[model samples]
Structures are given as C-alpha cells and as structure tokens.
Target: MPFTASANDFRVAPATVTEWKAVYGEVETVNIVPARARISGTVVDVRVTEGQEVRKGAVVASIEDEKLALQLRAAGARVAALNSQMTNAQTELTRAQDLLRTGATAQARVDAAKVQLDVLTSQLTAAVADKAVIEQSAREGDVLSPADGRVLTVPVTAGSVIMAGEPVARVASGRYYLRLSLPERHAAEISEGATVVIGGRSNAEQPRQGRIAKVYPEIQNGRVIADVEVSDIGNYFINERTLVSIPVGRRTILAVPPQAIRTVHGIDYVTLKSLQGTLEVAVVTGERVEIDGKEMIEVLTGLSAQDEVVTR
Candidate 1:
C-alpha cells in the first residue's frame, strides 16, 4: 500500500441515459365552457368578475325584463279579478239552490247558477297557472354558472342588454394541465405514462415529476402536442408559461465518478490504468449527473470503454 491515493479502479463504459429537451408549457384547463343567460333581458348586476372561482348553479349575473314585469303584473291582476268573479258566482249559486229548495226558483235556474260558478272556478285556476308561469320567467332572469370553475371572461357588464343563451362568462372547468408543444422530430419519443421534468436544466432546484397524460395523434404546423399531468399543476397560474424538460431521446456515452476526475487550472484529468503503464490523462468532461445513487460525470472525449479510471 503506497498511499491513500491508491483506490478501487472502475472501468469506464458507455451507458444509455435519457436525453431531455427543454420546452415551454402553457397551463390550461381541460374544459372551457360558457355560462349563458337563461332569458333575454338587461343585465341588472354581475356578481362575479374574471378569474373568480365559482360553483355550479351560482348566480353570476341578474337580468331584468320590463316586459316580463309588466306581464307579471297583468297576471296578478287577472288572478285577482278571477277570484272576485268566482266568489260572486259562488254566492249566487248558493242563493239559487236555496230558492229551488224553497220552491221559489226553477231547477234550471239553480243548474245555470252552478254552471256559472264552475266556469268561474276553472278560469281562476287558469289565471293562477299563468301567474306562476310569469313568476318562473322572472326567476330565470338570474344567470347561473354552467359549471364549477374559474371564470375566464365576462364580456357583458351591468346594464348591458343581452339575449337568451348569450354568454355571460367563459369558465374553465375540470383539471388543469401543462400543454406542451414540441417539434415533430421528437414525436416518436413521447408516449403516455412517460416521466417528465417540471423544470428545465437551468433550474437548480430538484425537478418535480410529471407524466405524459396524453399525446395528440394529429400533427399540426409541424408540432406535436401533449398534455402533461403534474400532481401540483393546479397550483400554477392558468395560461402561465413555464419551462419543462421532456425526454426527447436517449444517448449512449461514457461516464465515471467525479472522484476519479481531478481538475487543475480548469482542465479536467483522470488517472488511467493499463497493462503497459498507469498515467494521468486529460479528459473532456460533460454535465455532472447522478446514476444509481452515485455521483457521476460524463466523459465527452479522451475516454473509451476499455479504459479503467482510478480515484484521484
């Protein structure tokens, strides 16, 4: 044993590792739907603004139609009038029945009175139904959210006249994802369930993991689109642009532990072992990485699979 410098020699060999490509992913919603007005009227008030989270059936805006109010008033008056007429007819029918029993009126007179009362009763029922129909129409003036989501667009404002079925707000519902577009050249490398890196190589923090949830079959504009499902992607801002690293391909290269390579004056050198002689050789190094829980660095040049490296 000469000194502590003498250590176990590792044979440097070519190994395949995933090649990553950096791309910007846009945060988007899976479903974009509109909350529409249920009835044609002037928007009286809007309860929500853009980016507000709302639940399904929550009233986003209230609409009012003067015509509907007038109709409701008319219906109320008609119901009132029908009730008065029916009450008078009931009194007349009771009096006529009394007269017929006392032999003071003909049976036909009492029969006619009873028919009049029945007719008034039916008219009163019809009037009440019409009043309820008008009241329902008034309630429909409250524009409701179509689904539980964040409101994206609210084009109409208070006092704006809009028609029935017109959009009051555009909502983004369902789960959010990072929509990535990559060049068509890397299409074959991407597949569902493939691991993805949340941040690119520039980020020093530990990369968050994501999965390829879906890959679109159609290639448009020479680009391949994919939906990545990151567990905490929902925390990202909608439509926010962020960088992600995807496994575009794989490459075979020689790698060795960093302990084997010693740097002097910015030049990297490693101890080489051979049958003829052992010497320190200058080696070109690539990016530093960890493989199998061991610190390793890539040897871009001055290295071969036949070379055995000793810890410096």
Candidate 2:
C-alpha cells in the first residue's frame, strides 16, 4: 500500500548559533576566612552559631580564662609592689635632703638616696608595662570574627577543649560567586572576563549572567577549574550547586522542527520532499535548542538550508 505524506513541509535555513557547554558547579563566596582561637583553653561560651551572620571584629566565642585571671592578679601585685617601693624611696630621699640641709647626713648618703629613687621609678615603669601586656593577652581569649559574613560551621561547642591558633568556626564572607569545573579541553576557550550563564537548568527560577574571574593553572583529574563573579546572589546559599553554561564558539547550522525528525530502529531520519520524489535522509543530530520559546533540533549533517522536509 502507498502511504500518503503531509503536503506541508519545513524549509531549512542556516541559523547563527552559539554553542554552550553546560558545566556543574557550586555557589561559593570569593573570600572565606576561618575564625581561630587565639589562646588554648576550654570553650566557655559561643556568641554565634552556625548560619548566624556576624560583623567584622564581632566577638564569636570566649575561652576559659581562669589561668589568665590568676596571672593578671600576679601582675597587678607586682605593679603595686613597685609603686610602694618607689614611694618609700622618695620619702627616704626627702629625709636625706632635710638631714643634709641640717648638716646631719653626709653628702654621700644624700646621693645614694637620690639614686635609689631613680632606680625605683624605672622599675615601676617596667612593671606597669608588663601588667599591660598580660591584660592584652587576657582580652585575646575572646575569639572575634575576621569578616562580615554568615558562619558556615562551628566545629567546637561549649566545654570543648581547643588549642591556640586552631580554627573554631568557618565563615563565608558573603562575596558570592560561582566555581566551575570543566574539562581540560575547554582550557583554550575559557579565560578571565569570559561570559558565563548560571542557573541554566529547567528548574531554575531566573538565569543570571556572570563573568569569569579566574582560571586555575593546575589541572586535576583532567578538569580545569574557573571562578566566576555574579551579581544576584541573595537567593543562593553558600555551597549550593547550580548549572553553568559557557559559550565556546559560534557557528551556522540548520535547525528543523521537532516533528520533521523521525527515528527508525536506532537511526534518525528526515523525509525530504522535492520534485524528484520523497526520500528518507539519514541525519546526525546535535543539541535540541530553544529559540524564543520555540524548540528546534540542530542538524549536524545530512541537511542544509534550501532543503525542504516533510513535517509529518
């Protein structure tokens, strides 16, 4: 039996196309600073929790300072003792001067008293400085935030033992950007200042345009890494995964309606309609692209503009 074909046909025309490669990556901040404990002690208090926002120089946690308190007391005592000794030396110098004026104390005794007063004055100055240093160390027991951002992780809880210079909390500095990993083959195509489209998946709420900020020199696992800067980031959380697309190059290709393409067995074909007769033509397909909300199948080969294909 002879099967009738649809009279309507689609004319193929070369369309200017830009090829985009979809890459998977995560949302991250450009600056991430770890807040560390300045002194070794048991965690006494935590002012901020995970996901809490903090300002620069804000106190994040406090360490136990019982030992520091004792040291501070000892320092204060030393300073007080120096002050007492200075006062006594000044009194002795005054007595010696009065005796010298009366011809009761020798000139050598007055000179010795003046020297003692001067020495005690210097000792007092040194003691006061030492006390100030101890106070400063005690103040550092309170951990502070390094930057303005949300706390990502707090590894230690209250009552946890911690060491000096160990990171207690990890923070995301709120300068959000995207980190993408692509194949090493794309190294030549991507560079700093290139355009990147983010949130390109079907479920994405809004597509965003980003600029490539950096391209890492080292390639690991056959993949190249790049960082992108984006503007709209209030809706995205740190470390959230998203889809990114980068354009490699532009070319001209034939695009046909979806119904014009047919699958027989494992091969794709299109029905060509011409004055000669109807013929089934084999085609190699590329991406299914959407233009202005209209979907079209890209013809990689076996078709060109000026060819007419049956729609049904």
Per lDDT, the best of the predicted structures is 1
Positional deviation of residue 145's Cα in model 2 after best superposition, in angstroms: 1.0
> What's the lDDT for candidate 2?
0.85
RMSD of each: 3.6, 6.2
1-312 per-residue lDDT for model 1 (tens digits): 111223578776667778989899999988999988888999999999988999999999999999999999999999999889988898898999899889999999988998998898899899899899989999999988889999999999998999999999999999888999999999998999999988733456567889999999999899999999988764566898888889888888788887888899999999888877788899999997656666678889988886777875
Candidate 2 per-residue C-alpha lDDT over 1-312 given as tens digits, one digit per residue, 9 for 90 to 100: 012223578677777767789887788887889999998888989988888999999999998767888988998998899888888998999999999999998999999999998988898888889889888888898999999999999999999999999998988885888889998988888889988888744564678799999999999999998999887755467878888889877777777878888999988999998788898999998888865467888888999767878987
TM-score of each: 0.90, 0.77
